[model samples]
Target chain A: MDTTWSAIFTEMGWGMVTMVLNLLKVLIPLMVGIELLLHYKVVERIAPRLGWLCRLLGVGPKTIIPLLVGLLLGVTYGAGAIAEINRRTPLSKRDMALLGFFLFGCHGIIETTYLFWVAGASALFVSVLRLLIAVLVTAAAARFFRLAETRKE
Target chain B: MNAFTKVIVDGILRGLKTALMLLRVMIPVYLCVTVLKHTAFFGVLAGAAGPAMRIFGLPGDAVVPVVTGIFTDEYGIVAAMSGFAFDKAAITTIAMITLCFHSIPVETLVTRQIGMPAWKMTVYRLALAIATGVFTGWLAGWCF
Candidate 1:
């Protein structure tokens, strides 16, 4: 019994270390890159050009911030940005719903790409697949269900 | 300490702190996954998920997150994926579909916040995810 317990403990400990190290290797660099991009206002400049695309999915310009952040920082960071935006802007229920849907798949692009690449998959395929899915799912939700209707004024 | 040196020191310390915090969270997550795998809980989950998982050409284990992803998010699915030894194409396809539509809890909550029915959103997202997974997987298999 003791031996079994020790074996389990060891496996768990090793797995924990491996997971943590892997996550850090990806996260730290991505965070720094995102910070630099934001500092340069590069994302902001690019947001407008993507405006037509965003509109097709029924989200306003302001929604781009969280999407960009989420795409770089992962879900928690995206949620944090959305919460902050909600606090500051009083986004309607519709917008928040849309934001939530958008974030469902959001993760740092380079980070996820790298992770997938390391896992022996195609990074470009993963990145493009994620983006396409988010757009299609969000659009379908908005159109077929009219989920935006319940937005509180 | 000179000003430039002090700034660099501060930045390094901040990075270290962040790294430590991430370690704290990741440790528990890894343990949970490992334990789930060893205890055969994952197998049971896979078995239960057999029906839904079939659509994605995944074993029953694939169902746990495909179903859970409906409630939680893609992270849960990704976490689940960490336990498997899937081939590159399979992994890409799985990740693609999961990323496309996973997270039942968040989705349900958001839809409810907007006054949409939670049940409806749940069904729709699951169906969409399954459809996308099937199409993508088939396409990937054909190409590869």
Candidate 2:
């Protein structure tokens, strides 16, 4: 066990530093840019426009706040934002399930977009495909489960 | 409202909203990254599980999320994916599979909180995730 531990540590020691540095490089700019955007209320105006579209996927306009946040930020943050919204507005189980499905396909947009870009793929293609898949899958799941019918009155 | 003023107001508000929303997200994400880095246990587990992961075309170090799913959840799995270096097609396929079913502990807990049966959610998520992973991986490998 000791030998195994040592071997693993030796290999990953360098990776840990690189990982930390890389994470900071990506996250710092992301946070700063996001802060700038929020300070200007960019997402606020965009949210209403997306409401009609969100409804088709079985989510309310309220849910779009976290979905957009998750896309711009990442999943953990997205989930955190949703949890906060749910606390205040109280989402239904059906809505939560739908949100889960939507998130499964499309969170961490910027990070994933950058990754695709670095890999020689079109970032727009990746983003659009992910959103398309998320919407289609969520819609199918919502329909299959009769989520709308199961909603609390 | 005049066109120029409306445009300026819209742009300024939009920018502010986006920034605040970003700050909200960055705090939690930064914490997650920090904890993941300092933990020695994750590296050990990843090493131990390395052999089994290779069968799926993942690196030996890739077992961290699989192991994490046994205890915590799939968020760790997604975090793990962010740390690796696979081709675009491979990463997307793996991510799809992971997103479908990787965080057993977390998914089960959340589903139960929402009143779904944990066992059913587990079985359903796992089965769907594996099926999706295999199919997508094969298709991606073939096409790309």
Candidate 3:
């Protein structure tokens, strides 16, 4: 290893500049888009309408709130919302687990996907594959737990 | 709505804050990884881990980001792997896996609070992340 530490740092400094610039380009627009979506209450309106998705995830209608929140805002916020909801009406362990699994596979879709895309992954691949995997795992678990048939009554 | 302008401003602020947060961690990690790549230790470690990573169509050095991602988050992974060269397939695999399971300690608390056991969620996520990595590796090879 003939390369000195300072030399590596100098190289890394240049690399960082380029990387940060590329990241910011997409990130700024993405954050703006997210803010617009939130400001317009897109998730709020769209979440409740995903009853079929809720059914597919093997949870009741209310579970959609945390699922959507987690998908849009990331797991912490989504889980925070779930904690709030669970306090008012205790959710079943199965419901919580299903939500956890699904969100684990695909959360913070907009930012995460775009960030990875900037890092060289395909945006569509990251977003679609994660969502697909999340759905598959959650739906399978829901079936195994016999909760998928819990449609809106 | 008049508030639309405020929303855009908020977005820009939020984006700056997030970029700063990521840079705080990423810059140091990137520098460290870059230095480590020149070290004999990293070479040995990479050699040992190479086959395991090869299963996912990644080089051994790729483990740095994957493991960093487990302890930290996507930012850490990005920083850790900054110096390495990977094709799109490998990057996609890493992204898919890390996205499935990152920031375990903090997120595990969220899961616990939400009524799921921390250990269970952790295990599920790790398993799913690996599964996703393998699947993405295969898919990317065929597609990308």
Which predicted model would earn the best DockQ?
3
Q: Highest lDDT among the candidates is held by which one?
A: 3
Task: Compose the digit string of candidate 3's lDDT tens values, residues B67-110.
Answer: 88888877788777678888898888889888888898888876
Which order, best to worst by lDDT? 3, 1, 2
lDDT of 3 by residue, A1-54 (tens): 345766876788788997799668766887888789878888779986788998
For candidate 1, write residues A97-134 as lDDT tens digits.
66666655445666667766665556767787667777
Cα-based lDDT for every prediction: 0.63, 0.59, 0.83
Which is superior by lDDT, 2 or 3?
A: 3
Query: Tens digits of per-residue lDDT for model 1 on B11-129?
Result: 54554676676555444554566567667677777677787666666666555445444544444555555655677667767776666565556656755653444675466555655
After TM-score superposition, what is the CA distance of residue A40 in candidate 1 from its true location, in Å?
2.5
RMSD from true fold, candidate 3: 3.0
For residue A32, give model 1's deviation from the true position in Å.
Answer: 1.2
Report the TM-score of candidate 2, chain B only.
Answer: 0.55
Cα lDDT tens digits, model 2, A48-150, are 8886767678676687887787777676677677777867887776777777777656667776565435433445545666677678878898786675566
| Candidate 1 Cα misplacement greater than 4 A, ranges | A1-14, A80-101, A105-108, A137-153, B1-19, B39-45, B64-79, B100-127
Ranking by TM-score: 3, 1, 2
The list of candidate 3 runs beyond 4 A from truth reads A1-6, A147-153
The worst-scoring run of ten residues by lDDT in candidate 2 chain A lies at A115-124
Q: Total backbone clashes of model 1?
A: 8
lDDT preference between candidates 1 and 2, better one: 1
